[model samples]
Target chain A: MSTDPTANFSGDIAGDILTTALDWKNAGKGVALATVVTTWGSAPRPVGSQLAVDDEGKFIGSVSGGCIEGAVVTEALDAIADGKPRLLDFGVSDAQAWEVGLACGGKIQVYVERLDS
Target chain B: MKREILEQLQADRADKRPVVLATFLKTGEQRLLYLVGKKGLKDLDPRIGEAARAALIEDKPRTLDTEQGPLFLNVFNPPLRLILVGAVHIAQALVPMAQLAGYEVIVIDPRSAFGSVERFPGITLSNDWPDEAMAQLRPDLRTALVTLTHDPKIDDPALIAGLKSDVFYIGALGSKKTHASRLERLTAEGFGPDDFARIHGPVGLSIGAKSPAEISISILAQMTAALRQPAATPASSSAAA
Candidate 1:
């Protein structure tokens, strides 16, 4: 099928995430959406950044550039399984940043919730 | 009732309606408000509703920190569209450049030969009269209309449509003298000086462009400036610089 330019959400991360979540839900795959709700000081991604995860751990988009996606993904997977929501706080401290392999200190609050219906 | 929001949001997205999806950070409560369509709820908190309206107007997604909590006002604006009234050499370059710069371009020319797919491969071509084409295209605030044709028959109708609508930027390709005459003609046709204020005559930023490609670059640059800075006026043909 020829791709319609109007239907393509390639570059828009927010639209892509929403589209992916809906597609996964329609495909019988449990899906969860993680969004960056708040950020503090040098957060890689600004607020409203999103990462959508499928039950199989397949994912697209990002809540952070790279710093906390892994953690968010893990939380997202759990959210999909439990059908529960999680608000994750990452890199609030220098020690936390070091643990997450972030050289600098910043904070990001990500809300992960399963996509229902 | 809740699934309705996502469904409506997707519907609005499909229809190219500008919307703001406001999600309360603390509660995950979501509300979708169309920027210019049927107002969803009259009872919505005035402050938050105003914030959503402001976000839609600004065409920027932002998280507003209110006394209750942080609300992520995600502005999903319809893609910016560029309506080129002439399928000339400048459009040959401008079409791709505008597409690259994230605009959906529509090339309008009543001349079937000039607007052929062979000339504008993979581009949206409208072979209708400029007024009819522009009426169908319905240039909104997110759209920029450029008339590269020096012909008044083509460009004047497009300019009239642009002036009547809220199209953010309207530029016409011409020399300073040509633009002065064009303005006079438009004024004679009932358009006032205030209506012509937004028209960027000579149609480009003055970087001493000499080629069609360079001229296209300047036009795109001016369009970008107009979209991003609606209040600031760029140097136009009438300006001394």
Candidate 2:
């Protein structure tokens, strides 16, 4: 909070995590991305937020509860290899927006895509 | 490695995504303690010569802004999104709720009247049909799809497609009887019993809520709990890296 109000956050690649991942793909590095679009009450995060994964399953963002990111990373690699994108879901239970833990009883939906360059 | 991760953090945080900072606290043979949230909240006490412990939290962790600058262990979301299959009253409420929660929400409906930018303000509204919209929006496990139309015509295809896909949570608004009817139609359309189980029919918890606003709150609350559970755990060693 000084001469630059934007100084608190990102310096580079802040606005384009998607592009960075795509750049990785363009550079011959396998890349996968996941996004949290919808969530229920008490969700820790919001919509349009993204997470990226390289061929190595290392992640860059979050979707929901963080329980299913590993799963999405694996799926993203598969998508990258095949040039396809997949949509995935998770929750407290198969019923009543129950994913796991998270007593607020909210639900979130994420999309995992393997961006092509 | 820290610099590369910092580059990713710059991207995620610049867009104002919901990111949590997980710092290494203590380390053992197969575990690491962590501190979550903005650097303003705590003092970093990483043991210089020792391995660190990284505790976990579900708030989209990101490691940027510790006293030492960019430390590892921060995890952010990948273009997080919220896809609303039905553009109805509940969606009106859900939009702001989702935005406040840090999701990039998109409202999709076949009816242009319902899905107009004029009505939605700053949101990304789509006039495409729910099924086609789901395909276009690409809802996944990191996203939540809620069918608020209460009409099978709108939510049916979206639910069927969403259930089939890996979308994290699939919920549709309806009463018990309506949900039962929905199940029958989906089953006829080749949706299996297991697939039916994936949907939060009679969506939202049994909060005994009546108003659309309350129901919206209940529904969203359920979804938030679902996503945060997994963000709280990840061992640096003895775990998948």
Candidate 3:
């Protein structure tokens, strides 16, 4: 357990993840945030996970799905369309990723977009 | 929705409201440590001293390697979340598990018989279709969604809608055979076969789970794994495309 004094994990990641995003959003900068909302069988994660990305192909945070991130990054690019927030998803509600990633363990969905100022 | 809460946390940070973010990282021993703060970010950790300050107090994202393994520094300015799509018997099991995992869970279901405050006590309850009720709840990168409804009428449309949005983990309950049938139907409705393959059919791993409640445990366990680690393997869709 990292009980480091003066270290705040809550504010840093949350801040680092959103600070630039919100700044870009406020400055009318193009930014996208993709998050994991659900999962299915054999997945390595739970729901309520996230991954943040930008139009330039820069990224922070994890859509958290291991290898499928490349695909999710593609979705983040789509979110940059017209600079509006949009949703993106990968995997099935109950099916598994056989060839692409892992099988019966993915089924992840994400929301992407240029942060609303 | 998990995003709403995360948004609130963001607002709290912008306003410098009191908040804390805790993540269970797999470190040298996979220890459970919470990063607590609301701007001051000091005096939060009891182990704080002048020597270990550099490791703990740094003005950047961190990755700490402990005796167990690598400790992933997950930020949570406003705490954690819990987004539930169904209010069923299995949910009864998941809600507690989520809360135990340090999440604030909110459940949604349209059926009154299934979604009742009486049944799900001490948790946020919303009686609405999973798809329609999404707007009411907000989910973010830090948020996760767990759909336990086995009924396609409730699960499918909601899932399709979720598929198009930014919510993590769209889990549904069904067997491999049931999933195959569902996949055929989805393909008939224009969903690509590759797309259909994303679903975690049978809902949970083949841990030999039988009942709904037991399935819920298996499913939640899987969800926890998804959160704790990176997606197991990378997909090769480009090869197919």
Highest DockQ: give the candidate number.
1
Q: Which ranges of candidate 1 are over 4 A from the true structure? A: A1-15, A39-42, A81-85, A92-97, A103-106, B188-190, B234-241
lDDT of 2 at B6: 40
DockQ, 0 to 1 scale, candidate 2:
0.03
Cα miss at A52, model 3 (Å)?
Answer: 28
- Model 2 bad stretches (over 4 Å): A1-117, B2-76, B230-241
State in Å the error of residue B66, model 3: 24
lDDT per model vs. reference: 0.77, 0.58, 0.54
Candidate 2 positional error at B153, Å: 1.9
- Measured with C-alpha atoms, the lDDT of residue B105 in candidate 2 is 88
Query: What order do you get sorting by DockQ, best first?
Result: 1, 3, 2
Residue-wise C-alpha lDDT for candidate 3, range B82-174, written one tens digit per residue? 677778888888788877766678888888888898999888898877777765554543456666676777777666665555443545566
Least lDDT summed over 10 consecutive residues: which range in candidate 1 chain B?
A: B232-241
Give a tens-digit lDDT track for model 2, residues A1-117.
011111122324434565566556657787776665456665555544568788877677666546556666777778767855455555665442343444445556655555544
- Model 1, residue B25: what's the lDDT? 67
User: Arrange candidates by lDDT, highest first: which order?
Assistant: 1, 2, 3
Q: Best candidate, TM-score-wise?
A: 1
Worst ten-residue run, lDDT, model 3 chain A? A1-10
